[model samples]
Target: MDTTTYPAPQHRTATTTAPPPRGPAATFALHLGAMAVAMLLGMLLLAPVATALADAAGWDQAAAGPEAEALVMAATMTLGMAVWMVHRGHGPRAVGEMTAAMVLPFAMGLAPYWAGLVSAADALVVGHVLMLPAMVGAMLLRRSEYTGGHAHIRARTAWGRAVEAVAHRWPTLLALGLTFDSWLRPGIPPAWTLLLLGAEYLVIGAVRREFHRDRLLAAHIAGFVLYLGLAAVAATTPATVAGPVIAAAWILHIAWDAALHRADRVTWRWYAEACAVIDLVVGVTVLLAL
Candidate 1:
C-alpha cells in the first residue's frame, strides 16, 4: 500500500523567447507599388486633357513638343501624389533633401536645350514645364520613405566630424574680403590662379578632413580653369595683379567652408551651405568679369 501511494516528480517545461518583429518592408513596398500605379494612371488620363488644353491655347496639335508637355503634366501630378505618400513620415528635412536631389536630374534634362540638343520649344514645354513638375511631385511624395533614417545613415567618422567643425567655424569676413579683392583686381592667368588657390585649400581640407573635400577641390579647380580659359578667349584679360585677387578669393572661399563646416557640427548642412555660397560668389564674379 505504501509503495502504491508514492507520488511521481513533476517535470518543468522550458519556454522559448519569441523572435523580434520585422521592419515594415512589406508595407513600404506595397505603398511604393501603389504610387507607381497611380502615376501611370494619371499620365494616361492627363494626356488627353493636356492635348485638349493645347488645342484651346492654339498650340500646334501637330507639334510633338506640346504633346510631350501634356504628358509631363499628367506624370507630374502623379509624381506629386507619390511624393506625398513617400514623405508621409518625413518633415521639412525630407523636402530639402529631395530638392537637392532634384538639381542633378533637372540639370540633365535641361542640358538638351542648353547644349542645342533639343529645340527651345521642346525644352521649355517638355523639359522645364512638364518634366520639372513631375519630378518635383515625385520627390515630394517619396519624402516619407526617407523618414528618420537619414541621420543614422549619414553618421560620420571622427575625422569627418573634425573637418566639418573647422569648415563651420571658418572666418566669413576674411573670406569675403579675399573674394572681393580678386574680382576688383585681376592680374594672373585665371587657370594658374585657380590651381594655386585650389591646391592650397585641398591641402587644408586633406589635413582637416573637411566635409566633401573631393567635391570642394573639384569645384574650385574646374571653376578656376574654366574661368581662365574663358578669359583668355575674351580679349579682356585681367592684369597679372588680378591673378592674386582671384587666388585670394578662392582661398577665402575654402577658408569659409572650413570654418562653416566646423561651426555647424553637421557635415551635410555645412557642405550644402558652403556649396551654395561658393556658387553664388562664382556666379557674381563671372557676371562682373563678363
Candidate 2:
C-alpha cells in the first residue's frame, strides 16, 4: 500500500565513474621517490646484515665479496618492492607487501650463505630465483589496484610523447635480440654486449624531450668512463669483470633514476623506458662477456 504513494521509486542511474588517472610525471615521481627511499633503507639494514653473515660463516669478505653483492641485491629487491608499494597505494599494506617481497630474497640468498650451506655464487643464484617468487607474489597481490587505474595521456611534448610510445612498445626488444645474437655467435665478448645495452639507454634518454638533457648527458659520460675503467682492469687481470662493472652500473642506474625522477620534465613512462633499456643492455652485456 505504501508503494502506491512512493514517487515512482525515484530512479537513480548506476554511474560507472572511473578513478582519476595519474599522469606520467606523477607516476614517475611516486615510483622514483619510493625506490630512492627503499634503497636508502636497504643500505641501512642490508649492509650490516651481510657483513655479520659473512663474518659468522667464516667467508672471506674480500675474496668472496659478499658485501657488495648483498648490497646490490638488497637494493634491487628494495626497488622492486617500492614499485609494488606504489602500485598498491601508500599504507601499511604497502609496507607489509614490500617487506615480504624483500625478505624472501634475503632469506633464500643470505641465510644460506650465512649458514655455510651454500657457496656465495650458489647463494646469489638462489637469491635471484627467490626474487622471482617475491616479485610475482607482490605483483599478484596488487594486481587489482594496478588494473583499476585509469589510462592517461603520457607526455605533452612531441619528443616526450614519441619516446614514451617507443619505450612502451619496444622496451627491451633490442637488448633481447642482441643477447640472442651473442649466444648464437659465441665469439662476441660480454663487455661489448653490455656496452651496447648501456648505449641504448643513453640514446633513449638523449632522444626523449621529457628527460633532463644535462642529467642524461652526465649519466652517459659517467657510465662510459666507469665501463672503460673496468674494461682496462679486466684486460690486465682477466678475472671476473662483472663484479665491478655491475656495481658501477647499478649505482649509476639508481642515481640516474633518482635524479630523473626529481626533474620536472621527466615522465613515468620515460623512467620505465630508461630502466627497461638499462636492464636489457646490462643483461646482454653480461651474457656476452660470460
Candidate 3:
C-alpha cells in the first residue's frame, strides 16, 4: 500500500440560477387579483362564518359593535390572503407585509372611531378603500421580492419554519379567539357555556381513548368536577364572585392544555397551543370585565 496520503479532491458544487423577474406590472396585477379574492372572501364568505360561529357560541358579535366587526372583517381578509399567498408559494416576508397591509387600514379607521372623530360607517368605508393603497405600498416595499419571477419557496431557516407554521396553521384559532373574546364583557357566561366546558373536556379525552390511562382518567374527572362547581357558582353566586370564578376557571384550563400538550396525548399540539392562548385572552377579558 502506498504510504503517501493525497488530499481528497473537492467535489464540484452546484449553483442555483434565479429565474427572471416577473416585473412590477405582472407582480402588481397578480397581487391585485389576490386582493380582490381576499376582499370577496372577507365580505361574502368568512365574515358570515364568523357571524354564524358567534351566533352559535352565544357570543353576540354585534354587541362588540362596529369597530370589532370591522377588525373581524379585516382578520378574515388577512386569513384569505395568507392562505392564498402560501398556496401561491410566496415567501414569508412578502406574505407578512401583505397581511400587515390588509390590517393597517382597519386599525387606522378604528382609531378615529374610538376617538369619536368619525362615524362607524364612514370609518368602515374608508378602511376598505384605503386597504388597496396600503397593499400597493407593501408590495412596493418588497419590490424586488414581489417582482422577481424566481421561486419564492426558498429554503427556510428554523425561525422561518416556525413562523410559516404559525402563519399557516394557527390563523383560524386566533380568529375564533378574536370573535369570542368579547363574550364575557356583557355578563356572566350562560349556563350552557359553563356546561359546555365539561362536555368539551370529556369529548377531547374520550376521542383519544386516553381515558383508559389512570392519570388521564383522574385528570378528566377532576376537570369535570371543577367545571360543574364553576357552573354552580356562576348560577347561584353574584356576578362579583361569579366573574372571577369563571375567569379563574378559564385561566386554569391553560394548565390542562399544557399537560396534554407536553404529553402529546389528547389533541393535536396546535389545538392545545391555540386553546392556551384563547383561554388566556378570555380569562383576562373576564378579569377586566372588558
Better of 2 and 3 by lDDT: 3
Residues 1-290 of candidate 2: C-alpha lDDT, one tens digit per residue: 56566456754343223453676446544544554455554454445455556667897666646645765566645643443343333344545675667656866687878898888788778866776566556645765433345233334577645544443443243234323333334332444444553455466665665346475577576776666665555445544554446434533555555454466233354455446555545545454555
Cα deviation of 163 in candidate 1 (Å)?
43
Clashes of each: 43, 5, 0
TM-score of 3: 0.50
Model 1, position 111: C-alpha lDDT score: 64
Whole-model Cα lDDT of every candidate shown, in order: 0.46, 0.52, 0.72
Residue-wise C-alpha lDDT for candidate 1, range 250-275, written one tens digit per residue: 44555545554566532444353545
Number of residue pairs clashing in candidate 3, backbone atoms closer than 3 angstroms, sequence gap of 3 or more or interchain:
0
Which residue pairs come into collision in candidate 3?
none
lDDT (Cα, tens digit) per residue for candidate 3, span 1-290: 88999999975433233554466688667767866675565555467677767887889877778877887888888877776676455777777888888888988987888899988888888889899899888877777656665355643588766655655654354545454535534344554466766667678878777678587788788788878888898888887888888888888888987787788886777677777776777777777772
Better of 2 and 3 by TM-score: 3
